[model samples]
Target chain A: MTAETQVREPLTLKRVGRFVADNPLIPLVVLLLLLVGVLEFMRPGIVNERWIGNTIKFAIPLAMLAACQTMTMLTGGIDLSAAVAATISAFVMATQVPIVGVPLAICIGLLPAILMGLVNGFGVAVCRVHPLIMTLGTGLIATGCLQVYQRFVIASGSVVPDGLAWLGTGRTWGLPNSLLLFVPMAVLIIWAQRRTGFGRLLYALGSNETASRISGVRPWQVFLALYALSGLIAGVTGLLYVGLIKAPSLSLVNPLLLPSVAAAVIGGTSIFGGRGGYGGTILGALILTVLGTLLTLLQMPEGARRILFGLIILTVTTIYIRLTEQSR
Target chain B: MSRLITKHGWTAGLLSILVLLFILTRMIQPEFGASGLDSLSRATLPFAFATAAMAVVVIAGGIDLSVASMMAVAGVTAAVLMDGAGDGMTVVAVIVVLLIGLAMGAINGALIVLTRVPDIVVTLAMLYVWEGVALLILNAPGGAATPWLRQLIVGPFLVPWLPKSFVFLVVCVALIWVPLKRSKLGLSIYAIGSDELAAYRSGVAVGRTRIAAYAVCGLFAALGGLTLTLSTGNGEPIPGPYLMASVSAVVLGGVVLGGGKGAILGPIIAVIILRLVRMDLTLMSVDPNVTTIVEGTIMVVVVMFGGVIAYRGRQK
Candidate 1:
């Protein structure tokens, strides 16, 4: 109400705003830390080294999928087929791992995923189809292909070798083995999003396709690469799932679909595109993982946990929209 | 008629496909006579309603991903509440279910307008919330609807063997579609889809209209849920395959995913086409595994076909 008070108050708020904009992940990290603090106080056992390590392990696959979602979302496109692509990749790996060693089997497994991504990208970029429908179509195709493959190619098998257990549920130096892939993948994804020409293309295309086109940006080629990148990431995420879950089932990837999108959205990635980085998404994935752990600790119904995820996405999106809208 | 055809090309195309598929299917398995057609109509009824619901939201330049969960909640609400109640309460159950659905939709519309978040995200979140609530209400999916209530919707309404559900569908479409298409709000809805800023500048109540779009969508989604409950004779808490099926039906009907075009009839016919494809496959003894492939292929083809149409127009 007073001039001096109002001016000073806004100055303080401005400093806070600048801080948040400079490091969007700060709020998420604070939230994660606060959550951990509260959970530790409530249960006293949640902060142990083993639990923390295992939670990160559980989050690794989701974080990987979030990378896929985040990259696609950056380009104002989405990949509904990513989870299914991963499933397809895992299917190939599961069936072929015994015949071909792990490395060769992994390469063969990723081929289908890359092809699926190529189709999704082609449909979205060249054909000018909406990304939602394109991904949906490819997702269905992936599911159908899996069914057909099972019906004909290899009906029986998919036993995980004991050797892979160390990679999956094993630990090294008091940390999750899966962290090796996740930590580097996160760093690489963030770097690509920030430092790469392809990353700039995504931002430009998402922000204003028409202007980008007039500036000599070939949207088709960029979208093709972006979608293919997402597909490729999705395959890697799928292979990671084999490490986590130890076997491949058709329904394995179903639950991961929406959560991946939620992670990116919660991590301050604009669904409208042209904004966001992996730093926030890492925290987003961790937040969800911790929330699940807490809910399970509290014996909450699975349904309630799902609803909580929805509300969390809604709440975070609203805040980010408010934040960005105010800034603009 | 020609003008109508030109105006509603998607509807015309869908009708042709439906008619052709029907004739071919009945021919393939002569055992699938009038009864087969009747059953197919019955099978397609729920999806038709769901597609109709989606059409309203999509026409308003919005998307509603919560269709499956909304339907599930409605069906569960009706079945769980009406299980032991006498015949008279069936009406109450229907009314309550419909109101619940409208409220759920209102909640979605409210979140979107008040927060101004994207419709897809809001609806996607609602999808999750509603799915959770539905599963919570009846975890194992065992609830009952009275026989009379099922008969009321599915049994004879006017002429015997004509299928009351079909008549009800026609009536519902005429009631919503005709009036909605004629109203100023209808034009404004399409205007919003074509260009939100222009529509808003021209004095359209964007926020209010969107809420109404979603609310009306809720009504039809609930109706669709009721239809499913009656046919199944019980409640299904899980969203099941209805989500993808409805989405496929709507897209195949030529309703643009970005909204602003297409009609209720197009989606209705598309639903029949989908169900018929499965029915045809079943009768011909072909593998059902190909059904998902066919559905997916149809979605991609239909959307691509729209692109082609637009391209040709642009060239001209």
Candidate 2:
């Protein structure tokens, strides 16, 4: 074959652009936009500054948690302890804020999550425990710890301190501070994913650990750091959550688990590990927030809303799988 | 034979734990001797059914995280249908509820086989879908039951003063055990799970087997839901979202996470153990919250030990 013909046979720039255009997410994104517009039309004040701000504020912690989960999942593992870590972190922040102040408490809050992450990494990477079972065990332990800690120290049905509320419940420039915090975090994560050597190693390890190991990449180190980073993110998000609610309620952790996983998966990260960008995860988070809001507006019961949410993730993942299959 | 013994040793360990916990509970709370055993036995049955249902899919190297949600859907749908339909239609309603479950499972299998999404994500999504559908049908938790249907299925059938639920549970296990162990279909499940590409290339009909596995999972989930409704005689909407953890119970039963190994009996024993543990916690005056923690801890230790043993066996 001629050089030109051979070059053209494989995916070209034009084919790649076309593939992006034809992606299922593109249509879903469009559909989401239309749905938002329709909701706005039905209720003219639906997209007001305050409402939009609150929604963005409510979603930041979860979206950040999702971002962290996306990273671990991209590496072909999962962070089952995200919610538990968050729960523990929130409890620590709430109980300790009176003594340590907001900033230090925030830092301390992140420690539990980071520690859990280390445990996950150590077990899964060094000890070679399967990620699912290891995390399941750790997650349970962390959750139990949160419950025990809360019951012993924190007063039931009470908020910790009014001063600490500024972190989560504060408004700046007509935006939630937690929402503002997400901006820099998201940008930094995005930059790290694209520019850093660590990002490249992560993708390599995820795609083929044995090959990467043979190529002189320390797969275990990368796996450990990735899990640590995942837990760290969850810890950070948990502090943000405490700021938002100004309370330590273990129940908050319960609902957050499935949704974060759903968000990561729906954002196009392959569960088999490797091959997804954080940009899609951001959009995926937005889609999740929008869907929940839309369902509430539609006046559906909690059960129906839940079912629809699960179904949406299922549909999106299926479509994503099918599209990728076809492109290949 | 040694390899087989080592491989299946986790099941024995789990069974012993169940027995030990039961004995411990009797010693701790003599008041709970007979009644506690009965309550624990009843609680264990539903989860046993649910775990067995999930074990099928897990063995096929796929998981049905949505089993609990599917059960919720079936229970709600069946309850609503029975409530609306008069007494004469009870049998048909039962059939319809099971069919709903099968259909839901079929949809999940079709989506997975057709689109080839990872089974975890697909089932996770289906979990939400079924949950939503159940909520739409029943705005809140309320169900009416046909008395005859309830009496026939949910009420205690006596085998000389013994609750028939245990007998029936054992019977279900036997039926599932024989066909899956002795028949070709069962072998195909293990074959495909152990190595999908090899099974497919060898012309073992991987796609069909996977679809059938999910269908059976759904069928079992339906049975669990229906039995639960009958046993309680209350059709509450709450259990669908919460039932996902029972999948872990099956995994704790020594079923390998990625499939291709483990047995139904392991999960059955795990369920019994879990129930007994809960009873023991109560007898020991442990807070209820700690029960979940204990269960999670046991699962971690059991699975880790099991993995180590399996790795060693593989090396040998």
Error of 2 at B38 (Å): 2.0
Write the residue-wise lDDT of candidate 2 on A21-82 in tens digits.
45636745765687678778867878888877777787777788898778887778888788
lDDT (10s digit) by residue, model 1, range A136-181: 8889877987888877646557755454556668899879888777
Shift of residue B287 alpha carbon in model 2, Å:
1.7
What are the chain B TM-scores of all models? 0.94, 0.90
lDDT of 2 at B269: 86
Per-candidate DockQ values are: 0.70, 0.58
Clashes of each: 0, 6
RMSD per model, one decimal: 1.9, 4.2
